[model samples]
Target: MSALTGAAAVAGCGGDDAGGTSSNSPGATSGGAERDCSLKHPVCTAVTSDCVAVHDNQGATTLGLRMAQLTITKPDVLASGYVAGLVTQGLTMNLPQCNLNGTGTFSWLLEFDTTTGKLRTGGAMPTVDPREGYCFANMTAGEFEIAPTEIDAPLTDGAWSGEAETLNVPIFLETSPEPIILPLHQVRLTDAKVSADNNCIGRYNVEGLEWDNACLPGQDGDPPAFINGGKLAAFITLEEVDRVIVDAVKQSLCVVLSGDIVKYGTGADTNTCKRDENDQIVLKGDWCSATNSPATDDCADAYALGGEYAASAVKINGLCPQ
Candidate 1:
């Protein structure tokens, strides 16, 4: 197994110029772009094998990573006539709404679970049961919802441009009287994380300007990342939430960190073995790459899940499932 390594950053959240670009912006989503890469959308079917696993030989450990793009809707926060009157008679109390059309990718691993077929993230943990990470059961099991974590992909090509606007009346415009409008320029992921069987992740970028609300600094704002291809739209729906749970509970693919599962395990520890009844086999010698010491780290703590998988492994079949 080769040691995992890479450089990733979430471009600082600064002024428009300082902030890094997002996926699905104008001129970002072009033909043949990695961001737009995906399999054709099949008809909406019941919980089945929407997942396709590409296998590879490794040591005793079997790691699998699945990627999927999904559509999600954001619940809109509408202020009634009363709230609108407080701001300005005719103006509406507007807030950002998730743009379901935006496409994003989610990823998960497959390992063993004592109760179900496997154990994943996003479940009650021994220490914190209700709090968990992304997990998936067998191929048919749905994905589980864990706290949302940010995937850092550098701002290369295939990026999207967007903005978020909000109304701030920090002080009643005693003199100016007009509620100051705060506009936050931003970039969003065009693809949303739809399900566990279809979680997606990677160096995401975009090609089209999903132009949303345009504003002049204050008063109200554009639909930020939640718009065309932003945050809220990036959430997993209840339909396949359990799959996420299953995937989260499963182990991440070794190929995600070593180009091949065999190398991943060998690099980590040639003697490591996969224990069927015990979940310790895969994560037994888990260590912190930054610290280089065995520590109790969760799947999210692994370097591969942190966008280091690109160099460590070859992206095949849109994901790597060992």
Candidate 2:
């Protein structure tokens, strides 16, 4: 988010007998108003010149939070496939408002070649490994708005409630049990709050979230079985978040996720994934057994789901350090 100064109120002046004119020009006032609008105002165009900047800041922050949650609750997937080499390119964001009842949306096409650099594989489950691939998300039509009732005034000083439509993104998993297109949908982030200043959001909190990946059929046409629903809470100072974004632009972004993640629903079966006393993820199940088998392999069944598998901890190319 960028800081914008509000337009200075111009007093309308009455012409004098000598036909004196106001010092402020109409064009100048209009331009200034346009500049001050954006998120600075309660409403503005979704697509603006600073759209990329805003998205890079806010979007990346959102993604980082998501990654942090994934690392804490799904370390198996984060370690083996969703590594740090991934980056999103060609992004376009359209935020219609910076307050409640306003739309916050964006869409982007991905370029994995730049991020992965090369294909690589080797992990507990050799079936799926980190590899180069592509992904795209078109969430421009989704609704994003603030909750007026939750706002503590001074507008930019206190916690603010916000909500965004569920995200549906398509990803190409090149090295899974079989290369396939996985459409992750029904991904909702709820009870979100942002602590902010006039310039940016210093920290954010998400109370509940859910993402389902049952779009594709399983082996032999079985029902797709990856479902993740949980709650995530984390903190990242805006300054630190900005640095990460800068590094990411240079293709050097390394994110170390350290946070609290709670899993629920069908995914909480064994409850073996948990955080250590130091807040690092700790994996506890056998990772080598086949799914639903009587075998004692801890993570095998979990790992098979790729992005859906939960883990206690994850370190990705030094990005997500233990």
The candidate that wins on lDDT is 1
lDDT of 1 by residue, 1-322 (tens): 2122211111121111223233332222346254232222221111122221222212212223322211122111112121111222111101101111211112222222222322121111111110122232112111212221222322222232211111111111222322222111121333322222221223122212133211111122211121122231121111111111111112133222222345323233222223335443342223333342334544222221110111001112211121
Q: Model 1: what TM-score?
A: 0.18
Clashes of each: 81, 14
TM-scores of all predicted structures: 0.18, 0.21
lDDT of 1: 0.21
* RMSD list, candidates in order: 24.3, 22.7
TM-score, candidate number 2: 0.21
- Cα lDDT of all candidates, in order? 0.21, 0.20
Off by over 4 Å in 2: 1-75, 79-83, 87-166, 170-182, 197-322
Over 4 Å off in model 1, which ranges? 1-143, 146-255, 263-273, 276-279, 282-322
16-57 per-residue lDDT for model 2 (tens digits) = 111222213211143444211113331222223121122121
Worst 10 residues of 2 by lDDT: 87-96
The model with the greatest TM-score is 2
